[model samples]
Target: MRISPSDEFLADLERLLLDQGVAPDQARAAAVAVGVEWGGQSVYIRLRGPYLARAVAAAYDGANVGELATRFRISRAQVYKLLNKANEADRPQLEQARLPGT
Candidate 1:
């Protein structure tokens, strides 16, 4: 399956580190190590929140909300909130796509 860009980057970094003489396990660990915590949330979330929200919303439409909440370790309410935010964010783009006279 196609992986996310972050995952791909980590893999590449690990390989590069190994080539540079880092031990195998250490290279892998270093590749996955990211110091992203900020203000009670991860920098990953801060940067990718909207994208994640939209992905969550799409999954909510096709999958079990409870399972999604459990997997994300977030409350059901938060799941809904993300979905709503995603929908709101999508509205303007959707509106702009409509025929001008229609």
Candidate 2:
């Protein structure tokens, strides 16, 4: 599936990359590359780590699926898929966290 990232989202991503120490020019270039691929059609950009965590947290906080899809520029199905994957990955840590203090 493809995501048509919003201009705001792309700008945020560029800023994030910059914050992570990516060169300003490189960060902008990367954002632009992701934003415009396949002759100006939508492209796929995998959301991982903190991005996935935030999305899942929003869902758990009762954000509407359609709204999340629009905000994240992904389809509703992709949001569900990401949530499932995040839940699965977090299960072990969550269970461990519930254990007695270290």
The numbered model that scores best in TM-score is: 1
Can you write out model 1's per-residue Cα lDDT over 5-83, one digit (the tens) per residue?
Answer: 6666678878888987999999977876641222223333363367668768877855578987886777888888888
True lDDT of residue 12, candidate 2: 93
Q: How do the predictions measure up, each by TM-score?
A: 0.51, 0.43
lDDT of each: 0.74, 0.75
RMSD of 1: 10.9
- How does candidate 2 score on lDDT? 0.75
Alpha carbon deviation, residue 32, candidate 2 (Å): 16
Task: Write model 2 residue lDDT over 1-102, tens digit each, in one string.
Answer: 665457777889899999889999999999888767644565565665557656555556556877777777778887787778778778999988895875
